[model samples]
Target: MSPSQTLEDESHPSITAVNRRIQRLSLHLTPLPPFQPSPQLHMLECAKAANKLEVDKASLQCYMRGKNRELQEKVINFFESRPDLQTPVGIPMEEHRELCMRQIVALVRDAKIRPFRYVVDDPAKYFAITEAVGSIDVSLGIKVGVQFSLWGGSVLNLGTKKHRDKYFDGIDNVDYPGCFAMTELHHGSNVQGLQTTATFDPITDEFIIDTPNDGAIKWWIGNAAVHGKFATVFAKLILPTHDSKKVSDMGVHAFIVPIRHLKTHQTLPGIEIQDCGHKIGLNGVDNGALRFRSVRIPRDNLLNRFGDVSRDGKYTSSLPTINKRFAAMLGELVGGRVGLAYSSVGFLKISVTIAVRYSLLRQQFGPPQQPEVSILDYQSQQHKLMPMLASTYAFHFAAQYLVEKYSEMKKTHDEQLVADVHALSAGLKSYITSYTAKSLSTCREACGGHGYAAVNRFGSLRNDHDIFQTFEGDNTVLLQQVAADLLKQYKDKFQGGTLSVTWNYLRESMNTYLSQPNPITARWESTDHLRDPKFQLDAFRYRTSRLLQSVAARLRKHSKTLGSFGAWNRCLNHLLTLAESHIESVILARFIEAVQNCPDASSQAALKLVCDLYALDRIWNDIGTYRNVDYVAPNKAKAIHKLTEYLCFQVRNIAGELIDAFDIPESITRAPIAMQSEAYSQYTHHVGFQ
Candidate 1:
């Protein structure tokens, strides 16, 4: 061998050594798993399976529509048949407002739907029409709500017979378009703090409505900008004392103040109306601000069911305290919150239907050489949509229950039931609207780039639904009211006060869940246990009861140093959680009851499945809360997560029937992506590509 070859051989490692090193490295490197082929999911087959799912769509529809299925269909049919009522895209705000007003006019004159007539004679029918209108066009819904629910409701609920007799016909017919001028520039949730004053003028026998400062100007008043001829204006009622000449403030009262001339449609002499201009959404509302220099209405215009001004200008109210009278007046208007909650569910149904329908058609990556899988088949997409679908079902039942309770309260006038309804409405409204708003954004994202298109309806739906969280009642403030009411009930429970029907669970919950959860039950991970209605309800009750006890204790501990309001401020987040927990429990209970009460076995079974998904998904999302308190073992939490996914899969299999049960007409959805067939083709046509 040459010396150079010998050197090279020595410099390099021997072949045996290299082999040994390679063997050692191979030991550390993990081999990729053997490829298992993905099962091909055919879009047509999946769609067929969804349609074949044994769910009683008609029964489910009837259950969801509650009191007025035929009436709702009648109203929806009227709007669907009219091309003029169809929502147009990309219109200027002014044109949209005009369209909305025209749609309302059509409903009254063409359709012969008298909204105010139903206020007393048939409130359920009235609400049914409201829901139907809202499902078609949210802007038109708000206009109708402003004219009928708020303005006309004020007269019906707060006014005496004479006021109703004079205004109901014109208001209902849109001859006297009216605004509900309660919200001010600086004050909204605090209705008691409204700064507009209505001072009684004994000589003129009229009440002078004045906006004292810019802050007192009525803001966000629907119909005020162009159409409102009058307003149900809320202002502090000041009356001269009989003994002294000084005036006394008698809290807030509603007055029917004329805002515009009936003949010329001009602003009244003392009223200044300015368009609120553009908004993030609901531009069809024609929201405007109003300022009164000295707008005057006769004393008889006062909605005097609870408080009144006499001919001599003396203020009298059956309730002695000003606060009590104000409470009573506001209580009469809880229907707005109920209507919002009920209508928000409709928006959620529409959004979920759009997203789910599109998901069923849109295909993406799958097994090679096979047809691409429907996006709805993917686990991630199911996660985004199924829980929301389940929640829509849950809220439907809860909102229906709310309507029933409100209707009963109106008939019976039970004071306890009234308070119960108030608190319940606040909680449901806050929870449902907030959930719908958030879910709309999720729906938008779930549809990928197609969802981003304005023509898809997600953008407008979300934008308009977003304000549902603010108007009626600010969600945060409404939740605080719920917390306050819960605390009151918590104290009353200790004093041996009988709990109302809605809250009777509190007594049992305190007894059963105040202690640590049973080890066997906490660690139970079986599918049957996790899906059990009893087990699910027990878990919800435990969470709410524990939260109530803990929050009360925390507040007591902090109040010594922080004072009452300060203590509450410190525990604000905890209080919100507590309120939400309670509301969720209420919703779950209502859903369970609905399933049991369902007449059709197939529909009941379907509803049961949806209910299970809602309950388990809720618990899974808050598993940390359960884990922190040892209410659920780690293994059980895993089980819940697994069952939740499984339920999502099951629901996905039947998504078609579930959404179809909503029976929303395609014309109302107005999204090319939501088309029953050839969705992509319709989408292309919508975008002007064809």
Candidate 2:
């Protein structure tokens, strides 16, 4: 054969086979199926799921509203009726401040909602009105809080009857807008370290208030920028000894200082007031920095509840030491933390409601040739929002319990009760506000691009709530306070000292969990086992107990080397976890109690479902801790994860009714996407697309 003919005949068999296979595959290939047309089901499935259960929204609303429903309704209605009180979408900072002031003025003058009158007599009623206003407009809520809760509360709680008689009516009527000046530029969490000085002048019977330096300037004094005429200023009390040259420091005390002219609203002499200017949120609050230069006030201006100063420059207090007196003073002011925790639930309710409602209405991808399903139907979306929805309910009950305890504390003035309420308020305030601050962004993202629009309220809500974590007390520092109390109680438990109701769990958990040997075969993975309230509570209680024991040991072990402060710093993260675990247990306990106390079966069932989700979700999130300690076996942990998703689905079915139980008015929610009907149309109108 010729060379060319032999080459063609001897071609690679692999290449020939690949070419043949390609041709065969090409011959078998066909065009893809045509894209299916979108179906038009008119959201019937969403409506069906929304109305799946007999949620009894009214009964649930009444239950969630807690006490003073009539008063809360009145406050909500008053603002809802007034169009001017409705926060506009876009406005200048000065205008927003003016609007917030006007809203508060109307609330006091026109609506006649006087929280000051009920501050002591009916604290639940007081909190109801403040919380309601907060749900309406956060700026107005905070302005109301500053004027009534902080400034007015300081007078009522820290001062004697004479102070109330002088300032109560003025504050209630907005005749004298006031600021609570406790936080200095450099001293926010440490009131004991405040640099401002109030030196007694026995000859004049006056207190000369002086800011020692710029760091001593009172910063973030709400209402001081323009509206406030007076301030409840906290400063160190100094008493002059017999010798003209010697002065004694008497710790911190509150004094009423005039910051501005009451009639002309001019900055008072010796008081330099500068506006904090525009802020990320709460521009409506007129926050200002105040510098006092030897400002003189009558000796009577001293809020003499915890301590008193004689005209002869002598200091007297029933509490023996400065620390005890300070503790008592701060205990009385615990209402601020209580109110923050309470109002945070309101903000969470609004944000969750908006996110849930929008999720129900917003449809995305679905199976071909079928109507697009609501985002809420997607497990991913449900995971993002359902847990938050569950937490809102959990925090609601916890806040209500705190309010009741605080009210009882005020009435009884029992030392133990006061201490319990103080610690409880701190933990809840820190936990709930921190959760809310983060959840607001989650809610914003859950709503997709629409949430970014200012009209949806998420941007403003997130910004306004951002300060909540730091203000009442910085969350980290507050959590440390809780852990310290825990450690104290833990030590006291061994000394035969009785534990308070809040810490009683420590005793039982230490006995039941720490003393018992670990059982290798206790991994119950059934749905009932996972959802059982008893099981959930035990898990929570166990985690807290173990953390308490371990952290205490860690601190003790490290103290020998690192010293006390260094050891504390080294164990700080563990302490925070311990505090948070304790708080979660408390929240779960409160939630279970609320569910058990519900009168309506349908509402009880609904709340129970949400409560289950809250508990399981918490456990699932911290499952690693449970597994590492062998508290939960792998199978049980898997069951918890599965049950959490199952509970989310169960809760998602009635997400609409659950949010409706919050009963946040459309006027308050103000987000067009949160509307019950024609949401798209309302959104279009809101965005000026019409």
Candidate 3:
């Protein structure tokens, strides 16, 4: 039964027909022309599709798209104009990198369309522009992310006014392309362990930067292989050798280091650069590694807003503790985490769009008296896909809230607000990216074999997005960061210490439940109770509170015997669960708030159902946890299951419309089976099936 032996003889009739049909399909298949949907067209489609949503279609689309509908179209149109921007199959990796670099330059060169220039002037527009571009091509999205969000952002957030005045204009106009050099080969998530050193030399009034070993080399740097002329390098700032004595480490600080000659595009002396070579996806990005041997930059090159070195080489910082200062410095890059989360959700939308479209057009077995039915009509398939469709909507609103929070945080230097933003960003990035990876895999399976083909785009998307799970921050590690913050809040509340207003509701619930004589269990008489946003939020809060308390008890028990680190390690699993609950609470609250605040009744009603489905689905999945904590009765879990089934069916009818609200460009989807305009007869005729 080996493939070679089997192929030596003529294939069976069914196999022959399948092969012929595939050949015919291949003949008709071609690269899709570039496309970007106009905002008007997007609005019009929503209008036509509103009946399915039980809302004002145009209004819903506008609300769903935020205020960036027009900007999104412009982004699409920009990509459509440059075919080379598309990451075509079979192209040489080197050529792909070059084309991406060229397009990035062109996009940023034009004064009217230049995206980086707005990073400081107008952050909202900058975010919208980056999201739009990212939605089109992740490779392009990441290039922009590295240049503006990372390298340029480091200057905006970490550097002082002096650095801004010197580099802001050049950064916007692509005068000298740069990379964010932070992750070293051995110390990515554990950033504190990075081995690169920048030691101040008083005699020369310069900092001598060196990658002490191979492990300290900056690896996986976007724009590093070739194009970047400079980098914002993060290293342990070693105090200057002074007073005939050794100086201590000053902790991690960012420095503007020139790695390449501006004119020649050649690595400067004492710098070695090498490409990371091929990767699973996102090949167009020129990811590379860098090693420095006594590279020298002037003292002023340090990005010294938070921490500075005096002319006499004394290290000083405004923050009280080195850890606090480092945290503050790293917090400045929270936008990267936020952007990646947004991008993950965007990728999810496209994945679901292609899967839903394919399921609609693809036909399968039916009764003898009837024609074949679309796979979408089958309950099993709907069960797999519709919930993901609903989740896309849920995360969409949550991401919007996160983006707004980020914007507000940028305008002020409020400490508590910064911490809240950090926890939320870290939590959501882990939640959304992990969900996206699973959803994308499911979408690929939903498409059956066709999804495996490169032309369908899922393979590229899945591979490209897979890295996101670990890139900005490892999802598991990020969740720990979230959990650690939540635990602090919980402990503080119990000690009668001040708690942030952000934790007010959760804290109040904890106090109320702890004082109650009996545990609060689900008491809804009917599944109808599941649809109430207040009920759903309350139930979520109850479960989250119980879990938080459980985690607290477990940690306290472990701490008495095992010591701090050991206790944390032993309870890591429960801690992650606790973090997930807190995050889910935030998502539910955001979703409910969004639905309740809608101005249009119809839009509100439609979104209400969408929100219900998202919340109910989550509860249904975690019924075991709910029961474990005595937060829900067995009967209630059963009721949740029934309600979940009903909501899936309810969501199924409007699934297409829900995805359409995402307004993903057809050009971006690029799946042959997703073409609704093509007649089945053409396919049948080509296959000689008629």
C-alpha lDDT score of every prediction, in listed order? 0.89, 0.89, 0.81
TM-score attained by model 1: 0.92
Mark the regions of model 1 whose C-alpha exceeds 4 Å error after superposition. Answer: 1-53, 242-245
Candidate 2 CA-lDDT value: 0.89
Q: lDDT score, residue 604, model 2?
A: 97
Over the stretch 660-681, how does candidate 1's per-residue lDDT look in tens digits? 9888888778899999988888
Per-residue lDDT of 242 in model 3: 42
Residue 263 miss distance in model 3 (angstroms):
0.5
Any residue pairs clashing in model 2, and if so which?
Answer: none
Regions of candidate 3 where Cα sits further than 4 Å from its true position: 1-55, 241-245, 514-523, 679-690
Residue 200, model 1: lDDT of: 90
| Model 2 per-residue lDDT tens digits across residues 8-117 | 23367556666767987887796657887445233434544664567898899878866587887898889878987878777789998999999998988899878888
Selected candidate, larger TM-score, 1 vs 3: 1
The better candidate by lDDT, 1 or 3, is 1
